[model samples]
Target: EINEIIRHLNNSAPGSDNLSSFFFKDTIDYVASIITHLTNESSRTGQFPDILKEGKIIQLPEISNAINFSELRPITILTVLEKILEEFVYKQLIDYLDEKNSH
Candidate 1:
């Protein structure tokens, strides 16, 4: 489900459209929502999966060394979330991003 969203966004490339700004904003919002959801779910369940557990710190240099967002699919996002939600800390990360993105 998540991979489908990424695939669709990449295939449609918002830059190609007159409504590129809107598309970009919507895409960002959608991606943010997914992140937010995963974080919240992870917090409640204490079941952060290995990948997300590995990505606990968003600012890690290792993150940059890991998979690139440009190459990520929705399924990847889902997998990451599945891993992340296994831990309780992911909620904090989601809250931070939500607060930042809200403004």
Candidate 2:
């Protein structure tokens, strides 16, 4: 699942860590076990590392000829690891909700 998620991630600019999604995709074979362990540990402990939560915010103009701050959009670039963690949490939440609804 982690590998699938990493495979689908866009090759966009990295966050505070400066490691892009492409990097993860390229190294998934070597890093899959470590990432899976990290994700599982985080889930079991119900705690996420502060380092993974860090993001880099950059403002880009909504229009080509933008003139003011209002015309700009803030894009928060997060690490691929953070995104993977989010996907795991999201799947768990959805599964919980589905189970609740089924009952």
Candidate 3:
């Protein structure tokens, strides 16, 4: 799961926190243990840190660069940590499905 989470980190632009995926990629080992613990805790308690919930909603212009809000595409930029945890959840779900299908 750790490796899968690391693999899913995107090389996208940073958010307001100014944290890039590279930062997590470079220091994954140092944070892996804690991340694993957090994942387990979150899974058990159905809760996660509020910091992970922080995100930025940015609007991108449509094909014609229209000023109307309806023509803009909104994208949410979540923290790198959140992204990693999300990937962990995704892997867990996929593994569960695979195991079920093998039965």
The candidate that achieves the highest lDDT relative to the unseen native structure: 2
Over 4 Å off, model 3: none
Stretches off by above 4 angstroms in model 1 are: 1-26, 55-103
1-103 per-residue lDDT for model 2 (tens digits): 7777778887777778878887888899988788989989988898889898788889999999999999999989888788877887788789999999999
> Candidate 1's residue-wise lDDT over 1-100, tens digit each?
3333333443221211223333434565466467557666755796654543332222223344556665433321223233223332544567789999
Task: Kindly report which residue stretches of model 2 are placed more than 4 angstroms away from their true locations once superposed.
Answer: none
Candidate 3 overall Cα lDDT vs. reference? 0.83
Give model 3's clash tally.
0
TM-score of 2: 0.86
Q: How close is every model to the real structure, measured as TM-score?
A: 0.29, 0.86, 0.86
Model 2 misses residue 5 by how many Å? 1.4
Candidate 3: clashing pairs of residues: none
Query: lDDT, candidate 1, residue 11?
Result: 24
Residue 67, model 2: Cα distance from true site in angstroms = 2.0
What tens digits encode model 3's per-residue C-alpha lDDT throughout 29-88? 877888889999999999988888889999988868587888999999887778888888
Predicted structure 3, TM vs. truth: 0.86
Clashes of each: 12, 0, 0
Clashes of 2: 0
